[model samples]
Target: MPRLKKTVFFAALITFATLLSIFCKMENRSNAELVKTDFDQQLASFQDAIEKKLLKAVLQRNEKEIKQSFLQTRAKYKRLEYYIEYFFPSTSALLNGAPIDEIELGENLIEQPTGFQVMEGIIYEQPTKENRAELLNEVKKMQLNLQRMSRFNEQYQITDAQLFDAMRLEIFRITSLGITGFDTPDALQSIPETASALRGIADVIAIYEPASTDKTVSSAIAYLDKQPNFNNFDRLTFITDYLDPISKYISSLRLARKIPTVASGSALHDDAISMFQTNAFNVDKFVGNSTQFINNDKVALGKALFNDAVLSNGANRSCTSCHHQSLAFTDGLSKATGISKGEPLLRNTPTLTYAGLQRGFFYDLKAGTLEDQALDVVHQKQEMNGSLTQAAAKINSSKTYFSLFQKAYEDKSGKADAWKIQHALASYIRSLAPFNSRFDRYMRGDKKQLNADEKKGFNLFMGKAKCGSCHFAPLFNGTQAPLFSKSEAEVLGVPSTTDTIKPKIDQDLGRYALYAYPQYKYSFKTSTLRNIKKTAPYMHNGVYKNLTQVMDFYNRGGGIGLGIPVENQTLSADRLNLSKLEIEQIIAFLGTLDDLP
Candidate 1:
């Protein structure tokens, strides 16, 4: 109880705490080192398999053996995918990303994709000498990428938080990409590969917590090991029953161990346990700046600003001129009408519902943030023809607007700036994402929210219909899942009209207008299918008036299948062969995505 004795006791306690912190760090490093060793071994095995089995099989013209060896090599690659993707993402892309020409907006360079997706397409095709040589070259390039990953891994320090985060993301990858055949489009080996991916996560988990029981993981892996046909994989059941539970389990384990959640900004909330949950995504993470955050005051201010024609210069048009919240924030028109009477805007008025979730805005994917999007629309001649600078001045003149601005921000200058105005409007738009649609309810365990036909339609959309492959679920948009880092654009070869016999490709340059990339010609950012029932007149150009007509276009294989010339169509030209009944069912499922008023 004496002062000296108390000081000595406290000093001992502090020393013990410091030692404990050091021990935890050491343990984390040990686990990470073990994971890295496993990853390096897997990479080496993949390279060896490619060199010893796959290339030789191709050289010998043994089709069966080549496929088998390729599968084995991919299994190895899948095992280390978590770290490779999390730590060295660029290298990971070169090794197994989508086979497309991705444009780096910042660098203004188109990166030619070369990875597993590319190799899968080539290897699955006829083993011609040209194809064989191309595959070999791609394989060699991937090997070099693997070597580069090895170099990076040696210097990389994997934190416990990052390890758990990466593991959870892999589950999302399996559900959204692996099982959907986004990468293995040609081979349809997604089912088996999914099992491999789950096993890989389970293995990593075991290294950290050997006593951990992965019941959901085991169940999911077992289900996938059955290797059902890709077309009839019962993805709805797999996702709701198996994959979702696995993600929760991993998150629970992470929390139980008191490991930190991911600290960096992501489309997903740092502490979200399930991607399907309502609070999974954080719109704030998608903002252009910290100033563009949402609050009750900001939302209310934005709502008033959104409906005010004062921002439209002398055009007398407001955001509500094109977006009506009663109709899921979309104008009920084929194409948006401009300030000029009877003149249509270039693109359809996309719904503001869940607009905050995407990385890109507009049909052409021009703007990077909602704030940027607000600025663009205000300046566009046909849309608003207003300047944010002038609009800010007008807002400052209004006493009502002054009070709203005072409530929303700390600035008492009584002068509205362009960026602040943009941020307030963007914040209001950001608050629009309410993931409480019927489909969302059903996914979250209110089973009665969806009927039998609706359930079947969801399965078809995710599987046979191949809709999920493009419209990644939960958001049902092109925002890439798990990472939720970027939005995707697809060239669907949409026709100018509904006329099937004499179809003509829509002449809209789309994203090509922004970058002039050949692959971007006619490419548009994939719009969210949420609230499709309410937001009618679909597509960027609003080509389809109804969901049935939209289904028919996709059913017949988009514009290319409609006999329209489309060399760069990203959509498959193969007929979906969906029966009329199946189309109805799919439409029913889409109806479930509508949010309750």
Candidate 2:
């Protein structure tokens, strides 16, 4: 009996010890997970800072702050790879009852919706090599977007700031933070806080009053009629011209490059910031900070710099020389001359009027975003004849330019690149978006109604003429779709009214050149019909001189003259042919699109 009792006691002790050991291991793991969660929360704080910087730069044109902020922000992207490395294994361990360090392998990665993946789409951490490609693409996108927004924010003030914040936060949440990788049902779901912030950004920016920023300049502009020696410039022209004189600088005769020796950032004082605060305690200071976006002095500097030969390679032409506002972005020519050769540019210079309505830019549609376009144009031998390296060197040399860059891009480095200048130009172009056209007013029902002629013209446009199918409305640039729509090109049979034989089909295939698709022979991007009357000699080749003449050609299912026989013509042939007065009405309606916002 004594022997039996002793053996039972030993067995019990062994059982108890084993169970205790298991429990201790489990407790330690739980604590580690808690630490991870805390770390993740801290990471989120840094992420938010990046989002704010990117958004502020894009929307508010806070070039200076946004510049450094963006560089720092993008530089942090490489660090995000750790997210996948750290979190995925832990998440898997929790779900599968494995050790926390056990890695989640193979296809257990995140996926964004088709368009939102990679460069243009959502971002994610932790992935297979395939998934890493997507993340890399997204990083590139952030880099591009940061640069572009940095440039463009200057044109629009406080309201634009709000918009930028919303866009940045929304993008960050969807790409960087959202559950784009897990098989969990709600992995892709957005956090409530982030979602709410996005709505708030839009609402705030929408209500921002631009008057605050331009109040000083507006006063000056209003008083311009009362000023003396004003006869040298027109009323509208003079107010526009005011930008150049205020920000004065010297340009080089041959290269037109800006040479700056000093630098200063504009009025960023605490009291001034407080003054911009609205009636409510709006924390973002959306209203109060509105004026921070613009500096008449900087704008004036930028404006004069735009026309000055000092910035150009050859010094013979300026941005205005190519993009004639009077001619509506186009120089009234299919292609313009550069310093290189008399040979025409590869494509027609489209109007700057409504160019801002787009996400991706350029006729080729190769640029993923606006900043890409801005940067490319400067570097192109046929374009601005400037390099980012050279631009930064030249601008940093200028004392005033350094200050302008600091105010605009927040650094001497920002001035070093062409981004700040390009974005400023883009903002100016975007501001050219005027939506108050007579036809637009009639459509919105602000006016009584379109007359019978215009009504008939509208019907024809929507109906037989079928112009709106490609040349869509509201923006009238390309087809109207939700966000991220591809720019469309058409193979219009535009025979040279100037010459007999039409240009070869392969010669002017717009998108085909980009994609090298044989199908898109002779296709060209559908330009905004807004201000079409102002830009004459239509088509990619400037084949037609007037709307009536172009319409007549389209009426015949492309040129009756010699050309690659019009196959796959968008316009139907010989069907709903129109009368003369009908043509006049349609022309009148098109004319309505001419007066830009």
Candidate 3:
């Protein structure tokens, strides 16, 4: 009887435990509801700073303050951008949300153009002759677009907040691509929609915030992220409705520029934005182009073809292989080295920094212009390792390339002949002009830009130090335009580092290669000191490490090699006797000569 009673008690205990478990789950669900409300409150506080300032600016209708508000709005856009990159992600759809920054968001709120500043981030264009006209036209259009951008802002009655919001929304749209190839049909389209979506964004205010009101839930706060969706449009559909138009527009525009988008715009070949435009030479960045010298399209083409590896005998080195762009078109090497296992390039890779600005080309002034220089590099066995015929054949093989010569010279039967290739390459080389350093800005009336010491240094360069006379202004080069003026070829008695004693064999006779003039012995074209800070280990041999060392070396009149100098063994025909402080100022000023942003 006792055992039967115990069994009944155990059954009762099991039922009790099951009831308790159900009660615990119900309490947990209440906690989850509380956590969600708290999360929403936290987001509201983030925009409170922006909301307070903007509301004040609008209510007061203070135009001065509104302008200030616009500037503040720019700051808020940055803060929200930081929040998205850090806290919330755009792809998250928690009951839908306003784009990170409302002010910067666009009226159109669509895809393409608004995100980036004009021409900042790019996928890299492949410049070619066939599509050259189209690319150039597009560039011109882009420049024109910049000129016309103010009209759109005025038409939309865009507030500063709207502009910033549009750009911010663009950031996420572009980020979605993330280093991949994609068309921006919608990128430009988004600009218009951004204006509308921006209105849908809610301006919420926190009514109350009290500590210990309720750890789980707050009835006092009311802010939720909610954004509008266009009719029958989910995210993908909305994006397409807005973005597809932009892509179609840009594609059609290419036709006027004679860009052969797959047999002159066959419907199948329409989307070339994502497809690679290899050998599209005309619109590409110059390896070295003649635009600065003279806008010769053929010269530009020749430069492009010559710089390519396909023109080489071993198919290894392009002309650019040695002479690189970042190195100011000088191969960072003292002597030029050929890529093949054959022979060392006999001469030093002379800096072509301002070659286009020169009256003559090459260390010896052997080549009169860019065309003369490119032709030598192509035919010479050690350089391009290609004859005119071989280079032409190599170009014809590229389906993209076959049309370049035809379009460039208007000769449908263009075999790789001498004229077209040389002209284009030379044209490309000459366009590289670098003048807008801090120094240039100072010259062009930004007086406060220079530090007191740098100003003193500028005076030294012009006066006591005597650098400006030879280095020259703007170009920091001696060669002048119009080629008729005689360019200076000074015998600066530049000591060859290979020699310790008074030199004989190691002496580099510069201009003597052409005229065989005795006075031109050891004369080399003066390089532009602009961006000299970057191109280091200075001189013909890459000898010195710093500007200070170079300055001291010159001050001492050709330091080690010509320890005991003969006549004309110094820099600047007049000997510079600068104080130590003066040299520091000179170095400080030289540092200012960077490519202007």
For lDDT, the strongest prediction is 1
The sequence of per-residue lDDT tens digits that candidate 1 reaches over residues 285-398 is 887556666789889888899989989979488999889989999999989988789899898999998898888899998888888899999998888889998888788889
* Model 3 agreement with the true structure over 1-597: per-residue lDDT tens digits: 699888999888988888878777655653223333333343344235335653354345444553454344333333233223212332121111211122212352333232222111121234345333432333343334333432332333212222222223332232122101111121222222332222211110011111223211111011001222211112222222322332333333334333333321111122332111222112222223433234455555655675677767767778788777677667666566765564566566765654655555666666766767877887777777766567767677777666666666667775556656666666566555545567655544465667878876765664455465456543555542111133344445554553444543335556655555444556677666777776665665455556887777556555323454444332433346778998998888888876655
User: What is the model-wide C-alpha lDDT for candidate 2?
Assistant: 0.46
- Go through the candidates in order and give the C-alpha RMSD of each one to the true structure: 8.2, 21.1, 25.4
lDDT of each: 0.85, 0.46, 0.46
Instruction: Output the TM-score of candidate 2.
Output: 0.48
Q: What is the lDDT of residue 372 in candidate 2?
A: 64
Error at 230, model 2, angstroms: 54
Q: How accurate locally is residue 371 in candidate 1, as Cα lDDT from 0 to 100? A: 85
TM-score of 3: 0.47
Ranking by lDDT: 1, 2, 3
Residue-level lDDT tens digits of model 2 in 1-597: 699898999889999988889778756653224333433453455456555665554344444554455444432332232222222322212221111111112454333222122211222233345644544444344445434433443342322222222233222222222211111111222122222223222222222322223333233334433442211222222212332221121111101222222111111121111111121011121112342343444455456556655556655657786778788767887667766667687666777776655544666566755446657876777777866556556666777766666766455453545655655554455455556566655543344535656655654554346465456544566733212134565566555444544444435566556664444545566778888888886777676778987776665556423344666453334433667776787787788777644
Q: What is candidate 1's local distance difference test score? A: 0.85
Runs off by more than 4 Å, candidate 3: 1-293, 296-303, 339-346, 410-415, 480-484, 498-505, 558-574
- TM for every model, in the order presented, reads 0.93, 0.48, 0.47
